[model samples]
Target: MRLEQWSRIMGKLAIDDEVLEEVAAAARSRGVSSESLAQELLLEGLRGHKSKESLRQLMEAIAAMTSRDVEQTDSVELLREDRDR
Candidate 1:
């Protein structure tokens, strides 16, 4: 979407130029338009704000997967282990 369209949709949120530049740089690095990246960030923020419990559950799931011990294994495997336990 065009910058003007994004501005119209986002209204008057005072984002600093330096932060905008960083967002643009990151978007470029990821091969996505800055507008799209900004939209994703906006949507993510909205979701987190509107339903913090959902976000908390998502974070917990991610942490469970990432912080699993060697013996713990993947979530699917963990589930099976739990069933057998």
Candidate 2:
């Protein structure tokens, strides 16, 4: 809604027709303009980019999780026990 944000999105961007149509349909179903829907989609993508963790960090997290003893236990119980520990 701000002038800076509006200026940033003024340039053209490429998208497939099927994806555009889907975005338009969702906008209509939600009683919003297609432009608004597109903006929402773009913002969601940008937020995801900004928040994504590095591959090394992800691998480290996975290694830490898998190193714990989870044999013969349901995932939920394993997670609870891990958290308790």
Worst 10 residues of 2 by lDDT: 1-10
Pairs of residues at least 3 apart in sequence or in different chains that clash in candidate 2: none
RMSD of each: 10.1, 8.5
The number of the candidate with the highest TM-score is 2
Put down candidate 1 lDDT per residue, 1-85, tens digits, no spaces: 4445557877756677777888899999999988779889989998768477878998889887865455554799879999999
Each prediction's Cα lDDT score?
A: 0.78, 0.74
Clashing pairs in 1: none
* Model 2: per-residue Cα lDDT over 49-84, one tens digit each: 733467678878878877467655688998999999
TM-score of each: 0.46, 0.50
